[model samples]
Target: MRADRLVSLVLLLRRQGRMSAAALARELEVSTRTVLRDIEALSAAGVPVYAERGRYGGFALLPGFQTELTGLNHDEALALLIAGSRRGAQAFGLGSALASAMLKVVDALPESHRDTAAGAAQRLLIDPDTDLLSRRTAAEDVPDAIVAEVRRAVFAGHKLRIHYAAVDQPPKWRTVDPIGLVTVRDQGYLLATRSGDDRTYRLSRILAAEELDEPAQRPDRVDLGQAWQERSTRFRTGGDQVAVLVRLHPSRRDELVATALTVLAEDADADGRLRMELTFQDSRHAEWALWQLSTSAEALAPQWLRTTLHNRAAAIATRYEDSP
Candidate 1:
């Protein structure tokens, strides 16, 4: 808390120029004594902080203080601004601030570079799909504070206490040593260890979190990227790895074959019917795919899957037939 307060004090002074002890205390929600103490601490730490007494008196940094923005050329600055405006800016609560900052940087650049930067900004457009945006769940809205804490734990090898809720289960608390945070399509996940077992927890499901004092030294020989790859492979291979054969009309073959599932084999008959072998992880997803294909595709599976599909089809037909 004190560290955060100290950082806030510095940023506030940088933006507001000068602030009285009473004003700083009110803004920071700290006592006047605490404000004085903080100012003393800052001054001792070579922060260029100064205090004055009486009318129009307050604390301020010495004149002509300016923060430098370096390393970005004109093109680079425009690209950075465009990228930030796309989605990262909104996700990180830096949109307006970033725009303002970029404007200042652009204005400071030379004429030619500034023009190029302006042109790039005008041409850059990030058109996110409206349908996809609407489908994003609440789990996609991870708070910045939790993300910061997760990063700190990962860097410091500290353990963390997290309150997480899985899809179906009620919310529960766990103590974990965070390994990493992964950004999926729209959501963020925390990969962590619980009593030596590793699992992924959705950041959106985290009700609360705090860093613990205990440090869990990571294995010197372990490669995090490799470990994550292995975990991903296992997840993809989990559940029923069933092989199903389907016959599709030649007209529908291209559409059916374009899905992510691997095709094991294929054959075409003279009658324009095409037979293809496919592997799937679960019956539900496979069935959904077949349903999407409608009358054009028929599953010729491990007998059980075929029978299940047939039974479902018959039931659906009967329901319609029995309805007036």
Candidate 2:
């Protein structure tokens, strides 16, 4: 709504001091012309907004001006409360801070809205660590001291040194230019650069961390989301991946998808089962996933896999044959 946009404009200017029209438009996700019109409207409504003309000039509000906007509607307040109830903050070592902030949000709400919003938030759940099958997803543990030091380096744009435990490798200390931190499904990752090359380290694998006082030699600005996506794509495509053809029971299709990295193709067979072409990280990954399904899935190709499963089944049968 225009009213919301206008209020946001005032708040942005108040927070940022001065911003060019182009910059304001980008932040507001509108056109330069729309920003100009909004500025004119604010001025007409007795707002102390002024413009400057120079190579590095833009719009600014008079220093002492302030708006008395409460900033959140009832639904917005409820949304925030619901989001705050998730476990993401705890993964980043901010559980207590999140709890305190949530209390303050509830307290600041209008009397008519406070009780209802709080009640509504209690009824909705987000990102629980487990699902219906009673299978639990373990949350990675990172010490508070380690979290604090890593966070300091990332936010302050400084160099960070860490003792990392890489897979199949001994622990070693290395220095990196901290870029940002990311969390996905309860797992935390530090995205950084070492010797001008992209590097990602799991937070759980960081045995120790130290924030260096030296400034990081990195780009002044980074699109962290895009950077993460690119790295994920590279990792997924560069490994010694394996593709397999399998006949899977209809009920177990979802399970296979969760384990496999990608589903190359899938179609329903005449037997009402699914014919799926799947890709896994490697042959072991494919075998492990298929083994979980037991008789519900059959590996149609790669005779070696079928032989391995047969041998394992024969051994199990022989072991149970003499049971009294």
Candidate 3:
């Protein structure tokens, strides 16, 4: 690990010239003391690393010092550079590793193609934190320690015990044979099995985790993609899935689709509004989603849903009717 850190330290200085020890520590996720020690080690190894003295002083490599690396063609190099720009690595605690690898990629490209490839990659952006509408995307918060433990169990093929807080349920301890970890839409999930039954736990809801010494009772080789697809199919069809038919203003059509699990059918009404059949995880989910649209959407087919919304709106109106 120290060797990897030492190489990362060198590559970081190589890509970004003249970085202070404090700045280096932040980038490397270490302490300034560790950075100082690494610098001493680098210098002792005959690398011409020097420190400048001033308000903007920092460590830098001597001019013309370059590490020899294999070359990549223009498009190939740009593809890697752009992919490395994505923030997914942070979800798995590989953010620093990804940064270090990208630096090596840039350094490896032939000098003539290096600048152009890096420049072209900068022009394309993928998955910004905020959309064009200015609403910030929600990111799940999973502690570093929890993710580290979970990853260890998954890779080591050991059973894991986690204190998980399932939705609308009190927190509880669970032991499961580890399968694999997956992230979707920035939410992390642990796909495991308890007593031979498939189980999926949200990483954010995991309050604590412990990797057991016992080996996991799972297949030596497994198809994770197929497992996930099977689980998802079960989830989409298993619950008290509620299908609702609704008429929504054309402008709010996207909003309705975003909250629904499936859009079974859709068409434009005579008055230009959209008539659609959608399904949600449950009636509660359906009502909550329709409630958000308020006057812009109306539940047409499900008489129960329409009555519930009507009663809810009437209660609110009654409460405010006597207000000043």
Candidate 4:
């Protein structure tokens, strides 16, 4: 651990030029005496580190000295830079760390490949703000402390207490045995359980979190990919799932199937329209999704939803009738 701290101290000085002992101590999360000792260790180990005893200076590396810690080749360096540019790192509160590491990686690259790699990274874009459809999914920012806490619990197999804001509900504290952490579409989730029931909490919705002293009740080794898939299947299958039978123009079948949660069955109607048996999250969700297609989609079953849409359309028609 001390060796790691010494390397960090040297790197900090290399990156920051000169920092006061107190500043180095604060940055390394250690006492000023420990910083002085680490500086001494670096010097003893042939590192070109020295301290200046003036008001403005404390510790720094000799000029022209740089750490050759990166062993990445050209393609590898470009790949890392491309990954670093993604917005998803903010979900787990590693955006700053990733940026810092990326800078160091760039600095460590050889002069010959550095410009080419950096330029290539600039030309590539990951998760751009403006899409052709104008749909931008913002990355979530979990408080660093809360994310760190949940992360520790997930890794160390500790029970976690979290103040979670579930959909349509107020934030409330719950103790859960964390199964695993999952990220989908730039959003993060804590796959957990309360009393053996499967639960998934959006990291964005977690107001606060603390790792309990109690160990989580979970398997010894987990296959995260399999666990995630199993949970997803269970989730998609077991809810207040609404079934709908709709007849739509055959040309629009792909669009409806793409948007539906599941397509239970399909048949060709008498007029050659596509009759689909599909499921939605609920009535409201079904209505909202169908309404987006306008006349392209026709929700035949669930008369309640049909009535609601009929009233909504009539209100719009009345406005148009009075306008002229």
Q: Top TM-score: which candidate number?
A: 3
**Candidate 3 ranges beyond 4 A from true positions:** 31-33, 66-85, 263-277, 300-304, 307-324
Model 1 segments beyond 4 Å from truth?
1-112, 131-139, 220-225, 249-274, 302-324
Flag the better candidate by lDDT, 2 or 4: 2
Local accuracy of candidate 2 as per-residue lDDT tens digits, 87-179 = 666566555444433544554566589669967988987767788998887888888678878988997999999999998899999999999
**For model 1, how does the per-residue alpha-carbon lDDT over 113-187 read when each residue is reduced to its tens digit?**
866887897887564545565863432566667665765676578998888888669999888978866554555
CA lDDT, every model vs. true structure = 0.69, 0.82, 0.84, 0.78
Cα RMSD for candidates in order: 9.5, 16.5, 4.7, 7.4
lDDT value, residue 99 of candidate 3: 65
Question: Which pairs in model 3 have colliding backbones?
Answer: none
Per-residue lDDT, model 4, residue 60, is 84
For candidate 2, the C-alpha RMSD (Å) to the true structure equals 16.5
lDDT of 1 at 70: 31
| Candidate 4 per-residue lDDT over residues 258-322, each given as its tens digit | 77789999999899988888998877778887887788778888888789788888998888996
Clash counts for all predictions: 0, 0, 0, 0
* Residue runs of model 4 more than 4 Å from their true location after superposition: 1-85, 318-324
Worst lDDT 10-window in candidate 3: 69-78
lDDT for each residue of candidate 3 in 227-310, tens digit (9 for 90 to 100): 999999898877789999999999999888988888999999899999999999998999899999989999996899999999
Please estimate how well model 3 matches the true structure, expressed as its whole-model Cα lDDT.
0.84
User: Which candidate wins on lDDT?
Assistant: 3
